[model samples]
Target: MNPDQFQKNSMYIETPEDGGKNFDDDGRAKRTGTWVTASAHIITAVIGSGVLSLAWAIAQMGWVAGPAVLFAFSFITYFTSTLLADCYRSPDPVHGKRNYTYSDVVRSVLGGRRFQLCGLAQYINLVGVTIGYTITASISMVAVKRSNCFHKHGHHDKCYTSNNPFMILFACIQIVLSQIPNFHKLSWLSIVAAIMSFAYSSIGLGLSIAKVAGGSGEHVRTTLTGVEVGVDVTGSEKVWRTFQAIGDIAFAYAFSNVLIEIQDTLKSGPPENKVMKRASLIGILTTTLFYVLCGLLGYAAFGNDAPGNFLTGFGFYEPFWLIDFANVCIAVHLVGAYQVFCQPIFGFVENWSKERWSNSQFVSGEHAVNLPLCGTYHVNFFRVVWRTTYVIITALIAMMFPFFNDFLGLIGSLSFWPLTVYFPIEMYIKQSKMQRFSFTWTWLKILSWACLIVSIISAAGSIQGLALDLKRYQPFKPQQ
Candidate 1:
């Protein structure tokens, strides 16, 4: 198509007056992102605290089911994510009106109550993830301290530490980092977080490899079908744990909730969907490789007795400095991962408030503030208060519960089907004008329904695990 015709069809015109320098075709600031930045964001969001739990997750299902589930989730997530990337534009993948957020995409394609449902599910999942990150980061912080304590004292010494203080410290740090304007400004942070993820993941993988090669001088039994039903767990306990293990793998592969938002940051030319698809491929393959190695190797090292979080679960007490460094990497990675997830919530609320009360200065106004060494910054009062409050509330919730594995499983189960599978399938069908009950449509529906079943069972298991934990533990108390 010619430039004029393309502009008319897509509603993207670059006028001679401004020379297309400052603003994009959508009247927003020019998006400078390439697939590299998008991949970094994906990596930062995908490889998080969930990776630490994979060894335990694998142990729950044994050898055969664990690796199969990991590959299955990786395939499902990548396929659906590409579907979501296509939805970044509307009727046409390259030229239709832009849907800046996940809700926006839903509203454009599916519309009606589905949009509201999508928003509810997406935002709730996002909030839960931030809370989970808070809990995980605090655990890492506590692990660092306890690791050092174990080194100073004897390995047998009981080095108890409170997670509440570390939770507060993490919240304070988030309050400051939360001020970052939007997703577009987070590329640098995502790069750093992605590196941290690799660092800690590699360390964990290496430690596991060392343990396997060097031998722990103890028999570590592993089975093709996983933990023994009679010896390691009861029949009922095995059922629940298998479900929760699936949920943990689901959590490990989840980035679909923010996939569209990440796509929005990409510059046009090769087309956003095309760029996002490539990024998704790179990001998912990279994470899946790490997930497979970590989960398998850690399982190999610890067998059926694997701890929930190998790094922080006292799986490796010696080489104290290396363990401490890995935990620190985890904490730092979570710091950036928290922002990557929560920034969407921040943007949604701020945009809604501004539109609802357009004339209110407290809601919509921006003020200029000069800072030393950082130059001038634009401050919005409403954003400051709301974002800070959100961080504080999540931290408080983290302190109250702080069941890391259970929380991860629950959040994953709640979000995986709706945000990751169902919506994308529905949107793709609508956008492509697929015939009802067609062969392809039938298979897609089958996939969607299968995932929904997985979500339901996974959720039940997580809730059951949480209930058991709650019965035995007190709220606001240090876990270890």
Candidate 2:
């Protein structure tokens, strides 16, 4: 309860042989001490790309809502994360030794068969995020090229790829290069990437703010539209109502999976808990500060009617130099995306194979070989096939579904439902007998149900939006 007691409790120890396969000359010792650094890398990877979208999400919610939602979201995320970490301590651990994923928590709670169904839902959402981001980055790439500011400055072919061939080639290269075995070893690359993204974003935002400050003395009014109606539109109430929505924008920035990357890093248990907890706290706090500053500054600079792409919105009003900086920032941010999205596929493959072959027996490189990491002929001929497939699929979806705000909301409702809400509570209650569940446990149950219901509603909304788009693309079709 006290600080000293908390510290002691947090410093729980985990043995080397405790939670996994021993695959080196030194039985429990790690061959490469990359995970500590990788922890920071994973933080950058998880938090980097999607953050630029937060202000837009908040603006949609209403200006007043931004900071409130951001704070509330962070609080919920922090609480949920602590609960999840505790769940791992359950006496009857279901996912012992194996690195349990988000779906694994669902399986342990709801049982394996149910996990498959939940996994399907989760996959749909993950696929949406994957596709949406890929398309966003691709379009961003083209936009960077067309923007007069970046164009006038210099001409790097890699920096300006609008055609399909170059898009696929460039994206694939980034994805593959990111997957090199101990890519986590290159963790500092992520911190550098984050710093670059932050710097670039700051410069563009500052420029936009200066522009707005100099020439926006005149006031104007606009009619409220469908969603805009949610904000109090009365002349006196509108300003405060809009201000409240900033929290949701901030909330949109809290993604939690970065901590999972350290399954190998932290020794599993009570002893190493302090270091792990400290790391998570630091990562979350740093991320929250970054989001709040960027979101507030962005909305202040661009105003509520800003477009889906923050950089694009800034570019429209920014000086040429600032626009060029924005382009470079966006490009660097995409590299972070490559690291986050691509790593899972690579890890999945490596784990699949590592069980059968000794570390030395496993083959590597561009060539395909007979290993568990390699799938049967259909899916495993070349790693390029999978990477290319994801890029193409993502591109098509992005072009078709350009309502990125709605897409991200759906992603949050679906993926975060099982991942951050339901699974943590369920795993703690169901798996760990040592973990006590009080009558207030009903609160978590209620939260889980709310998350599930919200996800279903959001999914329906996505379907409705897609249907409407289809009608627009083919207006002559019979009314269904």
Candidate 3:
């Protein structure tokens, strides 16, 4: 089913008389997305603020394990994503009924209590991601101000800025863009965001390369096994950081939760699963190359003292204008990503509300609003109010606890095993009717169990990190 079909139910707008030419078999507008657009959405969702933390993750895991883990997670995510892509259609891979959302896929394939669990995990992760994006965007906004301040005043001078105002600004931008109906209309935004992501990531990578080449990194400390147990951290700290680092990488590779939704946007001429598989390969390979470059180069430049965020972490103080531009790119990229992640939640809620209150005009109505130069926009009062309120609440929560790295680790670890690994694996097994003790099934189960362990330890480390940060943190206070 087309997810947007739910939104179109209450609209008073006239339908096109182009017969069935302009609509899909599901009776919604025909999808125009190809592998390229799908790749753009994947890249936008995948290479987010999580990329900035790769240096820190590498530092914690060392040269050997760092790149190895990065590659490992990339392979795992890509492999499972392909599996999930096949689950986009039910009973048959290509010529079957459509499943609109990730939850819908689970309901169609894995039914019963697992579906409920999958929905809970998926939506909770989505909400957490939006909150995390709010915090990251504000941090980048603050970084731009700090970059300018350092350029004018000096590096040693205090350049502290309050994140609350910037977060409010971000929330305002999101509140406006969140009205763009559904995922079907976000292709342009995703493309722009994909460009911005590459912009900042390239800047970070270039800066790291320059630092390594300029001999400023001669005194930088690095090790094969990551942070020193005695000098850099205690043994327990090392253990916790390694787990946290794993979680960070997991977060970096996390786009599987939305893979089905993205595939749902594709035109079905050559088959969506085939196109999505190609898109996933392209997107994941492209991102994996960048991840290796940025993570390794950043670590090579700053070594063990690498900051959690590459662009905003004050690693390079002299290139102030470049830093400002990169931060601006981050802020802009996140503006689009915020919608990509949150739109699913918005769709789910609005769709559910329409069903429950089918007769209420307030819930089921879409009024035609004529705009200047932009043409007519169908406005749903419920959507505007709900989406705006949702953004405000996320912004407030971001203001309350704005720890970036730890929060990301927590979110990634919490969502990775279930959404990225277990659900896809289970759905594939069931849909393919694989024998329980078959080699492929057994190995898949082993992989799932292994990732579950990773998730547990990663979550523990993130919670510990958050706990440590909270002990020294004051709520609503400006961070430096």
For model 1, the stretches where C-alpha displacement exceeds 4 angstroms are 1-41, 179-186, 261-279, 313-316, 357-384, 474-480
lDDT of 1 by residue, 124-159 (tens): 788999999998888888888888877888789877
| Model 2 misplaced regions, further than 4 Å | 1-27, 30-46, 89-111, 114-126, 149-192, 208-254, 267-270, 346-386, 432-438, 461-480
lDDT of each: 0.86, 0.52, 0.86
| RMSD versus native structure for model 2 | 9.5
lDDT of 3 by residue, 139-189 (tens): 888888877877888879776678888999999998988888866565787
Clashing pairs in 1: 62-226
- Return the TM-score for candidate 3, rounded to 2 decimals: 0.88
Between prediction 2 and prediction 3, the one with superior lDDT is 3
User: How close is every model to the real structure, measured as TM-score?
Assistant: 0.88, 0.68, 0.88
User: What overall lDDT, based on C-alpha atoms, would model 2 receive against the true structure?
Assistant: 0.52
- Per-residue CA lDDT of candidate 2, range 194-268, in tens? 787667666655765675677566442222221254443344233332332332232254355444435335554
